[model samples]
Target: MPIRSEWKLAREGWTLDTTTRLLKATAFNPLITLPLILAAKYTARGAQVASQNETLFRTLKSLVALGVLGSISGFLDDKVVNNWKGDEWDWKKEVVVVTGGSDGIGKSIVLLLAEKGIKVAVLDVQPLTYEAPPSVQFFQCDLGSKEAIEATAASVRSSLGDPTVLINNAGVARGKSILDSTEKDIRLTFNVNALSHYFLAHQFLPSMIQRNHGMVVTVASLAAYLSAPNMVDYASSKAAALTFHEGLAAELATQYKADKVRTIIMCQGYTRTALFEGFAGKSLYPETVAEEIVKAVLKGRSAHLVVPESSWGIVPRVRSWPLWMQYGFRKGLKNLMKSWKGRQVVQPSETQVEKEKKGVEESAVLVEEH
Candidate 1:
């Protein structure tokens, strides 16, 4: 995955006065840095501060304290979203189709669904080597392409019948800072992570609407709500997908009068999975937890799941904090984001055979060795 950096340096064109206003009003702005910030504002702040010797030592001390606090808060907020501990999944009589089910969260979801005697279709570009249960079937498709998805959808319907549950879990994690990413990277992320849901839902949803029942589950990320350095394309694409999911749920209830078409989302945190790299050593949570969460949601619950079963509460409110705190916390999170580079891009065309041959490795060893 490539990095996207165009937005990071696009120059906001704000005047010195405007930037000064922002600095002064941000929460907990220290008196020591206010004048320096005001004088320098956007363009000249760095040079102006470098030349200033008038700031009191105590005030500088306060600014340093603020930096430490911000970093701590950012990390706390990031870790707060993973606290999802849940009950067992009852998957009797359910019909589910999971895209990108070759491995990772998608694979886990299929495995658990099969365990519960649910009929599951695993859609992927790779041929499956994982033994499917008597109730599980694998369908190969390039989910990023509309034509391919539509063709595959027809085959699935003809072979296994229309699925009552659609899990849009096919995703490629691109950890490149935006500037380093190719246009192809950006397009593939949006197509698979954002737009592919629309394609899949359209192909299978009419039957769901007619039957007065269906589940549409999407896997977004905690990054959608909080973006830092390194994952611009991946973060923003997930955000778009989240917004799309919200809008469609509203439409189903209002214009379409299809309240029976249940919509659920998983805004996952760090998990022990192959899609994420660079984050190898983090002890977040088992990926199996994510799979079970998917199963529980499929059984008839509307949910928002964050992995690791610990960070669930803090995630929703990470954005509601005052400006200074948000910036400081975000700055602190920069240190953590540096480790995001190891997450490999799991494209539709890439299989485990290719992954192993390409010499790509897991981001980190599993938190639980089984």
Candidate 2:
């Protein structure tokens, strides 16, 4: 099927709102689909009516095609070609620890892992809204504090065995510009987003290093590349994370010579989480799925960069662009993310308090020297 611009928006709108179901009957409405689509009619009324008609026409075209071909061919071919029998991202045997697990993407992961019979631990100042498994222990630990992380590590070690996988998922969105941001906001941004990875690694990596097995997943964002104006704090922190993942992966493979200590860096787009509720759109693909993030974390791979396919070709590999295009390109991005009010997305204060408490907990955990 030809994915025209209007068609994509039409598809997304239909997917979001099922009220357009009657539009499916117009499957073969070629006359309705012709004007602005098949013919170049520049009038506003012609273009608007043509777009509305085109949407209905293409949607039915898709629904009818699915009824005819997709249901039978795709389903049966899948039965013969692929193994349907498989453990679907089983987290049962893994002791998965997720930071910022009380809210947003992190919270979703905690709930999902718990359902899989995984021994999961939730670390966040705030509690998870969703009910987790009985085995899923909730520890209020702040990732930003070394002291709190140490304390929480002790609690986690006592309650659960040495963690098999550590998800460095705790983060904050200081969606402020460099000029607008206060000093505290800047420090808190890096502390929560970037430095916490170090504290958690110190607590969890030794066990993985000793056993020569573990996965460390870092949740970064695509904003690291775009570096949109309003997200200066968020961007810089994520940029640190992306770079740190590469270096950490190299160190695990070269310095420690333990490739088994796998690492993953999740560079995601917008998700339908409380943290991003104010954000306009929800991403269906390319953005990291909370469930998929759990799966990737468990696979214990070396590296994973989740990017939309369209974004790959556009990434700036060369030093400069054609001069005429630079101004508009930069301006367009700012306009696209302009609704993103920086002040709305602030770091959670309880996150730091959790860190302080975790430090208290870590003092109780014992670490045997190599």
TM-score of 2: 0.65
Q: What would the per-residue lDDT of candidate 2 be over residues 232-320, giving only the tens digit for each residue?
A: 67878988988888788778766886656777777776755544434544554322356557665655455465543234335433116
- Please name the candidate that would achieve the greatest lDDT relative to the true structure: 1
Model 1 regions lying over 4 Å from their true place: 1-93, 308-310, 341-370
User: After TM-score superposition, what is the CA distance of residue 15 in candidate 2 from its true location, in Å?
Assistant: 11
Question: Across residues 149-191, which tens digit of lDDT does each residue of candidate 1 receive?
Answer: 9999998888888888888887776666678776656777788
- 289 Cα displacement, candidate 2 (Å): 1.6
**Roughly what TM-score does model 1 have, to 2 decimal places?**
0.66
Candidate 2 residue runs with Cα over 4 Å from true position: 1-92, 280-288, 307-309, 315-328, 341-370
lDDT of every predicted structure (CA atoms): 0.66, 0.63
